[model samples]
Structure formats: structure tokens, C-alpha cells
Target: MRRAAALLLVLTSALALAACDRQAGPASPGDRGRLPLAEYDMPEDDVRVVGTARWTLAKECMVRLGFDRLRDLDIDPLPGWPRRPAGTGVVSLVVYASDDFRYGVQDPEQAARYGYQAARVDYERHYREKKWTLPEYLALTGEFVGDDPKSVHGHLVPKRGCLGEADRAIHGTVPQDRKDPVLDLGAESLEQGKRDRAWKKADRAWSACMRRAGHRYATPTDAASDPDRDREELEENLTDPEYDLNQPSAAEKKTATADARCKRRTGYVRTVHAVDVRIQNKLIASNRAKLEDQRRWNRDAARRARDILADRS
Candidate 1:
């Protein structure tokens, strides 16, 4: 009976351990110093929790950066009078492969291979711009990845991006910068028209870059294209609040403009949360049904990444 009890105890312990493993998170390769974002070490769940996390965190980052939670816009000719909430965002997830991972082991692994790198860089740059504004966090960027820093070329920040390895060789995020343009109080623009024109040009350039980088164009070319279907997806993203339709740079460029704003819009940060993520339309939840389909792609992405990395490693 004592022996039987010991065996049962072992079984119970093993089951408990397994359950804990299920709840636990994956390892976070980055550091915890002065960055605007938090690096979580959660296990990759069956659900695309990472994508959800990315969306939540990116929104949180934008809120911390300045703007109120995102509002929507009406670029339509005959705009619908009755509008809806801008909805939850679409988060992109990409996982790299073995060949590319090995290449990353070599010097010069190209991030364009996985288009997600651009937005990640934008996030980091955006974080820095905002973090620096507060004197208390002046050193945020300095220790971003912590001590024993990898060479910039290393898979360190994932900014240069994942070379495509491990269980899921991808990094993820929601690109709030794509929502719209805001004033770069630190940057200098010419005429008001020139500035607006620059913003328009910059938006086009970034859109082109998104395509080149392999992102599906999220915006609909035509509102009548799919009507409800199109409206649902577009509304659930980084938005352009009227408050964000900014004016001019308040001062001269004291620091290099963030790379995230590399494509440019009338940019900079006063408090920062005010700059990056702006939404035009004020959202109201109409259906009360949380959109679940949008996350399908991200889940497929996460599973595929795990499979590819498993095969490679």
C-alpha cells in the first residue's frame, strides 16, 4: 500500500508539472531596461495569444505614447452616418526557417526576408523617441537589450529581425504607425502644404514599402469592394483621430528622428503617446460579437513557424 501511494504521488506530481508547463511562457531573448514595451515570457498557447498580446501591447504602447485609444476615419465620398467601433487590431506574425537561420548565424542575414522587421524597428524607434522625452528615462535606449549585449548584427533585438529559427522563428506586432500622420515637433518641415504633401507622400511610400516587405495591403481600394467584410477589417486597426491630424514641428531636431518615422509624416513627440498611434473615427461596439476570424492567419503562422523550426533544428 505504501509503494502504491508513492507511485500515485509521483503521477500527481508529474501531472501538476505538465499543467504548469502548459500555462508557462516561452523565453524572451531581450532585456528589461528603459524600453517602452514590456517583454513577456509566456508560453506560446494553442490560441494566437502572442498576436493578442501584440495587439494589446501595441495599443498599450500607443496609449502610453499619447493618443486616446484609437478612433476611426471616413475617407468615403458618401460616408456612412451610422458608424461602429474601430475594432480590435490585426496582428502580424512571421516565423523564419533553417536556411535563413543559419545565414543569420553567418553575418548579414537580411530581414526583408520576413517583412515584419520594418514595423518592429518602427516600434523600437517609436519607443525610444517617447522614452527619451522623460528625463527620468533618459538612458532607456542605452540598456535596451541589457548587459552582455550581442553585436548589433546578432539576432539580438529582432529589429534586424529573426533569421528564422527555433520553434517559431517569428516576431510579432500591430503597426500603429501606419494608422496616420502626426506632428514631429522635433522635425522641421517647409510650408504647411509641403508638410501635408510630405505626409501624403510618406504614407504612400510606407504603403509601397509594406507591399515590398510582403504585407497584404490592409486598406481597401474601394469601400464598395466588400462593404461589410472590408469595413470590418479596416476599422480594427491603428486609426487617425482628428486630434492626431497634426500641424508643425515645435522645435529643431535635437536628436536623430526615429527610424520608425523613417517614411516621415509631420512627426515628433511632445509626450510621445500623442504622436504614433492616432485614430480618426470614434468607435462604438455595435454587434458585441468579438471578431474571431481575423486571428486565423496568425494562428496558422504560429503553428507553421513551430513546424518549420522543429524540422530545421
Candidate 2:
């Protein structure tokens, strides 16, 4: 359930940021060989431009308000993960599968030996620690209405500090009335794919593969959310006082390997990718106008951002 909620949040956030309004070019027959989902995904270049500009402006604002120390303190955009061709598809399935196979565990022996726990621990220990001072935080996140005051340049901060000011300067506070229909369209497409004859046939083949592997899962999702696995986890947590729930156990590693192998053998990922491509192309065609509007907004934003950065430089 937690995984499901996280997936929903990621999808919704992506769709909400769908601001490009340009029409996609007609897909060539050869284009089908490439990832179809990439066609409908957000423009990463535009996002980077606007984000860099916002950071630049916020830093400038902070300096103007007498927090010059933060001027040299590097403020940067959070590094994004390397995106898969299918965008959020694999992430959406994380609820049903183990982390080992979530991104495709190529070497099962290596995965079992090292497990999936090392990187997370390193990330928390290094990147997740507090790296910013209070003034820097205030500059980036704006002021609160009911907080005890902190002095920056011996002045009580105004409501909605540097971050808010920078935001207002670039993209005004009045929210756009438009909504991105991609999420609704994507959901509709998934349903349609489920009913698609080809998808259904592929699903059956995958299910048969799982059954052969001694797992009675009707779908990858079923394997991901296996009741018996959940029950075993619960029992283990209850009985073992020293068990670390965050770390994948031996049983989990075994299950993940089988799940990955079954998926690979049945070509479930390819099937799902094909279905998503067909649906997304149709959605793009129907929603050209909205997408174009978003594109225009983004282009304008990018232009303004460039201008702001240029002036500073």
C-alpha cells in the first residue's frame, strides 16, 4: 500500500508538471523501435532551464537581503535518477516486487551476495545529512507565518522570503487554471491495454511462466503482493527481535530472482511497453492543443529564466 501511494504521487507530480504545448511529430515506422513512452514524457531540458534560473534568482535575492555568506554556499538542483525508457512504469510496479528486481537485477548471485541495502545506507549517511544553514533554508523555502524569528542580517524576515519573492518574480503566484490530462489519459490507456487482446495473451503467457516456476501468480503485480510473502515477513518481524526489516532477507532475494527471471522469460516488460506506446500515441494526438499550451508556457518561462541568468552573469 505504501509503495502504491508513492507511485501515485510520482505519476501525479509528473503529470502536473506537463507544461509543454508543442505538437509531437508523427512517429515514423522506425520510431516504434524506440521507447514510445519517451514521446509523452516531460521535457527534461525545459525543466532544467527553469529550475536553474529559479536557483540563480533565489541566491541573488538572499544576497540582496544581506545573507551574503550564502552567495558562495553552492545551491544546486537535486540530481535526478537515470530515467528508464518506460518512464514511471517500473517504479509503478515496485509495490509488487523486491528492490533487487525493481530495476532489473542482472546478476542474481551478485545481488544475493551484496543485497540491495548498501546504496541506501550510503545515501542516507552522505547526501541525506543537513548541508544547509538556516538562512540558506529560508532563502530556498520562504518564511513561515508562525515561527519564532531567526536573525539574518539583523532583520526579521518578511512573509514569504527570498524563495517566494524569486518565484513571484519569475512565475507569478496566481496559479494557472489549466490541468494536464496525461494522468487520466494514462490510466485510461492502462485499462485499455488490460482489455487488449495482445496484452491479455502476453499476460497469460507470463502467468504460465510463473506457475512453471512454482509461483502461482496471475500477474507480476500478484507476485509483488504475494500474501504468503507478506505473512512470512510479518512472522519473521514478530519472532526475530534483531531482524532489520529494511534489509531484504534470504527469502526475499530468492523471490526477487524468480520474479525477475519469469518476467524476462515471458517478456512482460516488452509487452507492457508496447501497450503503453500505443496508448500514449493516441493520447498525444487527442490532446495536442493542451500540450501545445504547456509548451508555450515552458518556452516563455525558459526564455525569462535565461534572461535573468544572463543579466546576473
Candidate 3:
């Protein structure tokens, strides 16, 4: 039952995750952190407001359908909405607010503090602590009764549940199979950028730099993912049961710091950014119509969210 309820939570919020994985582009020292595809994606804060409104509407609908006890849960319905900078089991649900570490950890301070791990947030923990009842889950996820009508406490439930109804009210059903063009282009751009000769050259330089620093990694990504470290941790855990495998090790900190410095020294971030921007611009030009439609949808959703929030206030 717990497992089913968890699945319901995922289903309820799947629409929000379908949007985009946040905007990414080059940051030049101290700019507004704009990128080639930033204009096409909804700003992070707007996305948050929309999420809040959707949850608010869904919660209200739940009460109307007789789940009044939820009104006192006093827990945040939205967690990891805009994406936190650091956390365990990081899931990219929407566009993040900034370009910081989008191309990996560029900030030495952050690298020092977190190594390859993102700073932890309690989003996942919150969900685990607050479990929803099965009936509440059904109300949020719609009927599992096939084409037959379903009701809870004598009130009919929406086809897709209160969450789906709220989603439709804010996001609408235009472009039934909605797609996020900016996200598509951004992914394409990264692949194309990694293939660029300049990026390869910078990668080679970074690898050599890491080697000189006593850490041998073909790429910064490899160093961050660090399966080798994971293996070592697993082996060590057999002998010392107190070892927390997920925590950053001293070696990881050293490697991460070296990685940050090496990236700066080898101009890796700049190379990738330049290549990505070039590819992304070309992609945007080619997919202008799709992107425009996505932008239009985002604007409409944001407007509806604002009105909903305002009415609630």
C-alpha cells in the first residue's frame, strides 16, 4: 500500500516534471546567467508559483471530495519543484533558477564543500515522513475503476483526480502531447557540444591536469560520478560497518577541488559553453515554431497560476 501510494505521488506530479530539466547556458563571470534557450523556458520562480497553485487547487478539491483531514497535514505539497542545488537522489523535475554548476561545479568553494555530491535538501525526507492514505491517493490520482464512475465519501472524483483537474485548469489541454522544445534543444546541444573539437581538446587538458594532481579521470563527469570510489567504499564497508558510503571522502574533496581548478585552467567550461551556445542557437532557429508554442503555453500557465494564487490569497 505504501508503495502504491508513492507511485501515486509520482503520477500526480509527472506532468510538472514533463516540462523541462531547467535552463543551462554559459555564465560569464557576473551576468544575469542567461543562455541561448533561457528565453524559451519558463523562469524557475514562475514554475514554482504554478506548482504551488496546482497543489493548492488539488488540496481544495480533496477537501471538497471529503479528505478534510489533509487540510491539517501542514506539510509542503511541493518539494524539489525548481530543483535544489545540492541533494541526494537528485531528480531534475524543472528548470532551475540559475546556471550555477549547470556545466558541473565551476565554483571552487562549492566543490570544496560538496565534492561531487550536491548539497542535501530534505525534499525526499519530507515525502517519506508524510505518508498519504490510500483513499487520498486515489483522490489525487483519479479512478482506477476503468470506465466506471468512482466516488469517495459520496462525491464524484475527477477522471484524473483533483491533481489532474488542477493541472488542466492551469496548463490546459492544448497540444495534448506537450513537448518542451528548449529542453529537447538543450540536450541536443550538449551532445553536439561534447563532440566539438574544441571541447575534446579542453577535456584532454582537464584530464592531464587531474592526472598531475594525483587523480586520473578522463572527464570531470567521470570524476564526479566516481564508480571507482563507490567500489572502494563498498569494500571498506565490509570491514568497518560504521562507514557511510554516500558521504564524501577526503579523496573525493581533493579530486573535486582539483577538478574545479583544472576546469578553470584548461578553459573547459568556456569551451563547452561556446560549443553548446552555437549548437543551441542553430537548434532554436530550426525549431522556432515548436519553441514558440511551448513559450505560449508557459505564459498561459503562468497567468492562470497567478490568478489562482491571487484568489487564494
TM values, all candidates = 0.18, 0.58, 0.71
Q: lDDT of all the models against the reference?
A: 0.23, 0.51, 0.63
**lDDT of candidate 1 over 35-133, digit per residue (tens):** 111111122353234333232333333333332322221111211111111211211122111111110111112222212232223222222212112
Model 2: CA > 4 A from native: 1-37, 60-69, 76-178, 225-249
Q: Tell me, what's the RMSD of every candidate?
A: 26.5, 9.5, 7.8
Error of 1 at 184 (Å): 21
- Off by more than 4 A, model 1: 1-268, 275-292
* Model 2: per-residue Cα lDDT over 147-181, one tens digit each: 42454667655445555555556655411233534
| Candidate 2 vs candidate 3, TM-score winner | 3
Tens-digit lDDT string for candidate 3 (111-227): 787676542311233222334555665677563432334788999888667767888889884222456677567768878888889888888999999899898888777887788
Candidate with top TM-score is 3
By TM-score, the better pick of 1 and 3 is 3
The order of the candidates by TM-score, greatest first, is: 3, 2, 1
How far off is residue 254 in model 2, in Å?
3.1
